[model samples]
Target chain A: MGRTEIIEKVNTVFRDVFDDDRLLIGEQTTAADVDGWDSLKHISLIEAVEEAFDMRFTMLEINGMKNVGEMITIIEQRVV
Target chain B: MNYTELEKNCTRSTEGFVDSCTLAVLGTGATQHLAKAVKGYAYSEGIALDVYDADYNQIDAQVLDPNSELCHKSPEFTLFWLCTEKLYEEFCQSKQRSDFADTVIQRVERYWNLVNGKFRTNILQCNFLQLDDRVFGNYGNKTADSFIFQLRKLNCLLMEKCLAHRNVFLIDFCYLQEKYGIDALRDSRMYYVAKLPICTRMLPEAAKQVVDVIKAVRGKIKKCVILDLDNTLWGGVIGDDGIENIQIGELGIGHAFTEFQMWLKELGKRGILLAVCSKNEEAAAREPFEKHPEMVLRMEDFAMFVANWEDKASNINYIQRTLNIGMDSMVFLDDNPFERSLVKSMIPEITVPDLPQDPSQYLEYIKGLNLFETASYSEADRERTRQYQEEAGRAAQQCQFSDYGEYLKSLEMTAKTEAFDSFHFSRIAQLTQRSNQFNLRTVRYTEQEIAQLAGDERHLTRYFTLSDKFGDYGLISVAVLDKQEDKTLFISEWLMSCRVLKRGMEEFIMDELIRTARDNGFDTVVGEYLPTAKNKMVADLYSRMGMQPAGGGRFTVQVKDYAMHQTYIRRQ
Candidate 1:
């Protein structure tokens, strides 16, 4: 999967986790961009992405990503 | 199912909402996720649950403050999920463990009294979760004075206190911990970082349980379990494998089927109507139940049994018609995926749970679904199955009669009507909450409110229980006549169980009401027919029962001209 494909898939997850279908996730989309994306639900979003991608995110990878674009790049490398 | 799915679903806006309810959550720790999950799950269940989440660890301020959001919300259901850290703090401050337990109980009592006095919502108090004790370790249970022991005692005491209050309900989180495991339910990292005691992963599961309570309180509970015979009940097809060959005994693989049957039997005892819908020769399908010595359920246990080569969905339709219950109140269980899917597609309202491939997991899966969550249990509930079975017999006998009037008269039905007493209070309140179709006015009330009405001299509260030659229909009807107006008796609430419909019981109760009005020297007895989506069947009850339409869904009968419109029911 390329970064675009990963971003496409991850956007669905973002929309689903945040419960907003119209949510458009791009390079600049951060936790602050979405409603109900608090620290408590951050872990659940990561877990859902892991389940969707059929891979596990390291604690470092989970904590290190600052934006949706960085998360997509990490998932791109993992999927490949 | 999981927290993410629940959260996502909660965010989606719902249309065509039915049975809207308000719920407030006051937690000692983080509970916003739980509130979201609850809204999502409740929406999926067709309940538009508006949840109010209080500030973390500020239950006292939220519950006690009159100007707080909780006061403004005044939700119909209030859930309190408190962790043991605060209790532990109290324990450490106290000199003795017993003193700690006593003080905790006192605090809960004070808070509950304060909350109940201020608001009218039902309080769902969760028991303390045993988050491991290192003080006494394994010996904590052996010592009554230990923290763990005291906590257990405190939970029991909380249950006792909750039972004493009609509005307070203790939700057993300890049982949830046992089912899902303590570690899975509680996340230490989330607790430290976000103050979330219950893990985000298990928030959906917890919220599902809370919604179950809300569903029961709102009287949206499943009443029947429609089972599929053959592999669903036993290990194999009874026709292919003979009664003796079917796995349903104490030996090896049979134990799982036997345990499942035992659980179904227990459910039947608790008043959940059991029926069988299978595709086979009726005689062949029933032979195992008739002849098998190891069978835990007998033919008498089932209220309706349909066995034929017809499609299972059609048979379920037939069963629903015979039982006179809504499709939503029935749960169909079948081992075959095709049969389950067919029923699901045809009768979407009926609950058709996905049966696991393994038969042993059936018991745990059903228990986890909480399919039959009941708000109140009484002696009447225990007699529910027997009454339905008798109803089936009556239905069978009705087919032989030429006319419905002759059939009702032949049954020798009689009813004993009395004021709402302690014995019938819970059942009356439950019936008022749950009864929809035949309810003239669909007004729901709690047990405490019913008790007050029963005691008030101005209100003439009557609960009717019918018994024919077949059996007793335990506490089937309730009528509250308010005499607050001058020389007028107002029928504030009147509802009856759908099981006892079309039996002349309505006429019999009307006669009793007329007699009461004459005895009390009232000039006019007023009644109403409140129209709701579910209660359209009884929209014209007042007009049909010979009452003049006084406008605004109201009707009145003059006491001097009140003719006893009776057919069969003999009052006792």
Candidate 2:
């Protein structure tokens, strides 16, 4: 999936996870941007990524997931 | 990073989340461990949730108040059901059935109905129904009878409603109460304030009953009925009692054993694999099954046999291996709890149902399980009994032939693939859910999704049913085909029942799929896999089939790369 397509997908997952339909994700968005996006749900965000893309992520990459930018970079590498 | 960027990056990952997922309910304490576990499940399985502590103070108010905030906010999944034994106690202990029974019953009924009405959504209610302190006190026989009747009816009604949801999981606290007496619910860790608690840690005895139910949800009940020997089937020990002394058909205990064995035979005759694991002398065990005219189960009836003196687990393992299937695929039964415990400790996967105390309770135990859950059976499944008998016949005859190749030639096996139709639909559905060891992707699907895929032009689902002179292993394998722009055929789901694995039926299906892809103007055939624990046996299936791994176990072979010259070879 392209960056734009991936962004839309991420936004949908974010809304679902945060239980707030209005929640939208962007390149610079961080965990602090959304309420209830705590350590409990951080793993769900990662899992949703793998299922949506049919891909796998290592612990090293997932642990450093500070912002959407870093996560997208890794996903880009995987798709290619 | 922005959410968009995170989604973009994460979307392209080539691996799935963490390893195993264990749903840990955070009791009032241990919130930290529970949070970490939920995070782990989410990270691993994509979604993990914990109790939000709704109805913390006023459960009745939260439930009964029509304009309550929670009543309006429809939850995605109702996390916890507040089955407050304390609440029930408070209401009942008020010295007034007239004061709250009508209102309490109404609200409780509505709360249960709301949760169970939706399938795929679960309400993890702490099933704290009990006769704990005041209720278990002296009551007239009539009053106690009515109380038990109403409570049991409510439980049955709640369970029936919960069954509607495919994902509805009953974390059985009721079973816990059965194992551990109700007073254990008073443990401080499990119960504090208004909470009446029972847990695996506090109530160690009730652990298995609760843990087993959760673990079993990993797959459907794969094994049907576990056939027992001696007192369970034949009324007496064959070795000690002798064949003539064994009860088969007569008065008293003979009739009970006969009826139970016949019921088990019927279960096996209907696609449920039947096997025996008895700790009796060989002739003594064989005599009743083989020569006794009144016996319900015969020698040729059972699919796998183990009458040796080894641990039941070891013998069961041998039977499972010889049959080439998972241990979870068999249910082991014995008259002795020692043997039962041995197998339970050794093979945690097999379902070891508790043998009833009385001999008459045997049939009730078997019927209570509801093992046969399949709504539909294919043409092939109807002939399962005869097919198993034939497989046994083949097994016996193959002993005479030394060479595996010669034995293979004698069977004259045919390799033909049938396109997806109503005929093979349910069987294909079963293979996906039932098959474990031989599955690569091991993708489970609902019947609706399967129907759409089968009807679509872009996908072709096919099942391979193998047969020879012995008998037909009906629709024992399934493969879902996907089409790419350049006529590339992608293997979405591929699995074979382990019973049919050694017969080269996998290669046969692959050859046919490759041919179908070629005829459809496809250039290459690809094998795709999604990881699962029970399906590790097929991790190298694609590479072993001579297809080059395109990447991460995705093997794509060109039509020119395909070869069909191989003769079907199976070990005798």
Candidate 3:
């Protein structure tokens, strides 16, 4: 998948896990940009994203990622 | 349902539910996800569950304290999710390790006593999932000091402990581990990051296990399984294959069908009524059960059998009416997808499981559904199929007489009514939970509560058993009269099995109730009817039995003014 495609799929995961239909995310978006993106929901978000992309995240990557751009980069590396 | 759907259901509104229950969840680890999953699953089951999730790792503090939040909520059920990972950690730290199972059971007993002493809530304890540390390789099975050995022993000890406590029940988490495997149910990374013990993918199933026990305890259970013939019970079409060539024995691909029949026969022995609904001739259907030496299910095993060319939906409806059980309480299994879909679409309440295309996977698939979870069982359950067969006999004999009263009298019916004793506690409690249609007031009690009522001087409890020339309906009805102020006896509960309906059992019970009231020096007998979606059959029962209405569904009749009901049942 391309960067834009990964971002679009990740956006859908965010929308679903946050229970928001109108949620939109960009490469520069961080946890603070999304409502209800606390530590508990972050786990659910990681699980949903892994399922959506058919990939598992490393423990360090899951904890250290700060922005949606980094997540998209990780997905871009894994998918290729 | 998947984990995402269950999490989404957590936010769904439960405002319109007429049936609701309160549950308090406490765990040695984090239980936020499990509690959410339980609430979501209960919503899917159409039960409004108000779940109180305790703070993480607070099972001891919350249970030991008398004035804690758990006590304030006073939930109907208190679930203790004791995780094996936490238990392993305790084992690593403990100096004395050989008796780990016994020590852990002692702690569990303390928690049970503390909670039971404070409230009347039912305790649900999750058993340990047998996770092997592999320190001793395969020698763990023989070594008592091994973690795997202790875990297995702990599960068995928990079952024995629960047997002694009437209010305690096990969740069978170890069985789930065996089904899904450890890798699917556990995530070490998630456990380290979050205190959650069960993986997110497995939460819905774990929640379902909890909800199944709760549903069974609340009297929602499946009583009968309606089966389809052709490839469902055997290998080929009996009508076309001519029975002798049809495969059901030790031949190739026939072992699966034989094993399937064996499982169904065991279910029949467990008191689940089995009926045949096939689309073949009656002789073709009855031939294999009668003459085949390899067949596990005989003619006597089935309570009812119907074989014809009629549509399966109509046939299942007829079976439901004849069995007198709710459509929701019946599971119809057919190997044909067309029939399964048709039955599902026609009767929305009935449970129709889609059989796999392969016959070999039939028993394995049904075993995972856990469709027959029950809360209580007694020796009376073994006689259930015979009772239903006798009911069929009575039904067939009813057409012989034009007068219903004369038919009842000619049956030579006799009833034995006695006060609640230790021998009938399990069956009495089971009746109180299972009887819904003919139940007035619909008050459910557990065995512990029934024993308490039997011992209390303010209450008089009676359980009635009915029999005829055909067979016996063991512990068919129950009535509890509470002594009130002003020399009045209040009928707190009156419920009877639908199998014995229209057999003069109601009149017989009422006669006994009035007689007991008069003999106890109570001048008035009061009865009440609390209406539910299912109990409408007994709405006017009190009035029909000569009790005058006193408003608010309460009926009263003076002991002196009460006339003896003429029933065919002679008291034993």
TM-score of 1: 0.92
| Per-residue accuracy of model 2 over B428-545 as CA lDDT, tens digit each | 6656767777887877654434666789988877777677877666677788888876768899888888776656666777777888888888898889766676778788888777
RMSD of each: 3.0, 17.5, 1.2
Candidate 3 Cα deviation (angstroms), residue B254: 1.1
The DockQ values of the predictions, listed in order, are 0.41, 0.01, 0.63
What is residue B545's positional error in candidate 1, in angstroms? 0.9
Model 1 chain B lDDT-worst window of ten: B187-196
Score chain B of each candidate by TM-score. 0.95, 0.64, 0.98
Ranking by TM-score: 3, 1, 2
Which runs in model 2 stand beyond 4 Å of their true positions? A1-80, B1-218, B224-228, B248-250, B291-294, B365-379, B569-572
Retained native contacts per candidate, as fractions? 0.50, 0.00, 0.30
Q: B1-572, model 3: which lDDT tens digit per residue?
A: 86778888889998889879999999988888899889999999999999999998898788888899998898999999988888999999988778999999999989999999998988999998788999999999999989998988988999999988888989988888999899989887788888778878798999999999999999999999999988999989999998787889888898999999999999999889999999999988999999999998999999999999999999999999998988989999999999999999999999999889999999999998889999899998888899999988988999999999999998999999999999999999999988889999999998888988999999999999998999888889999999999999999999999998888899889989999998889999999999998999999999999999999999999999988888889999
Residue B387 in candidate 2, Cα distance off native in Å? 2.9
> Across residues B297-408, which tens digit of lDDT does each residue of candidate 1 receive?
9998988889999999999999998888878899999999999999999998999999898999999998988899988877877787778788878978999999999999
